[model samples]
Target: MTIANWCVLAACLLPTATVGLAKLASARLPSGGGRYNNKQPREWAAGLSGWQARANAAQMNGFESLPLFIAAVVLAQQAHADQARVDLLALGFIGLRLAYIGLYLANVDALRTVVWFAGVVVAIALLAMG
Candidate 1:
């Protein structure tokens, strides 16, 4: 596979890793429904609740972004678009997604949202370029 394809695959795996980490952390939390609901759990629950939204968001973003990533590759291949641009955009999307996940996990909403939007914009740009 191409570098772009590899980057896309890595991007796809990132959310899954986030969810697994969140769940592992959640499993260590003290038992309480409220603990799960809140963003900051007092203990290990903090990892669970604090990262839950971010993990979910990452998963959502992954689902939303995958199609565009794939489309970019296909279009670049079929339409004879610039391979370097496609690869760079794919890498940028992955980087933004990783940043989004980290910021989300840290409970940095504003910055995380910005990074998320950046990824979305990258994906949209790729699709439009098609």
Candidate 2:
């Protein structure tokens, strides 16, 4: 498989990784009552705050961003865009996404937004490459 194909898989997994942070934060709460409730995950997530809240928000954003990124990558491949450039941009998107999640968890809203914008740009660039 192409590197970009692997990146598409990674992008698909990103939200799960982000939400895992929220779950980890929740699990580490002082109270034993903070255990993850798989029965009602959204309700459990709704009560998250601080970095946990940001993690959940990042998870949502990851999901929201997937359609565009996936479509762009697939379309780019179908259109026979340069494979090396597509793979590089795919890596860029993943890198920016990782940075965005880190910045969100660190409570650096402004910089996180900038990274998020850069990721979007990368996705758009992938689409344009098609």
Candidate 3:
């Protein structure tokens, strides 16, 4: 498979991993089926906390990056760009995104921003290479 293809696969998997983390975090929160209620039951596991937001941010970041990744891959394939570089960029982008997620979960906003920008730069580089 092409490097672009591998990146796409990794991108897809990242969300699942984030979701698993979110679910685990959510499980710690109080269980409730009520809508628009913000009460921490005795069993509540700190819902809507920063950690949850970070997981959500990671999911959102994944979604935002997906289209760009796809576009880069398609453009690279069409333009016959260097597969190795594209693949390397793709891996780099994924790694940066993962780091961004970690930083976000840890509430490290500045570092998360840096990682987010790095991912964006990687995508732009891939697009430019195309």
Worst 10 residues of 3 by lDDT: 34-43
Q: Give a tens-digit lDDT track for model 3, residues 1-130.
A: 9867888898878876874676665554454632123354322323445676567567767888788877877797779898888888888888898888788788899888888888888888988988
CA shift of 56, model 1, Å: 2.9
lDDT of 2 by residue, 41-108 (tens): 88888887788888899999999999999999999999999999999999999999999989988999
**How badly does each model clash, as a count of residue pairs?**
0, 0, 4
Against the true structure, candidate 2 reaches a TM-score of: 0.94
Worst 10 residues of 1 by lDDT: 41-50
Cand. 3 TM to true fold: 0.80
RMSD (Cα, Å) of model 1: 5.5
lDDT of 3: 0.74
Best by lDDT: 2
Candidate 3 Cα misplacement greater than 4 A, ranges:
28-30, 33-47
Better of 2 and 3 by lDDT: 2
> What would you estimate as the lDDT of candidate 2?
0.91
* Per-model TM-score on C-alpha atoms: 0.74, 0.94, 0.80
Clash pairs of candidate 2? none
Tens digits of lDDT, candidate 1, 1-130: 7777898788778867876666665565566643343445344333444467567666666777777777766776567667788788888988898888788778888988889789888877776667
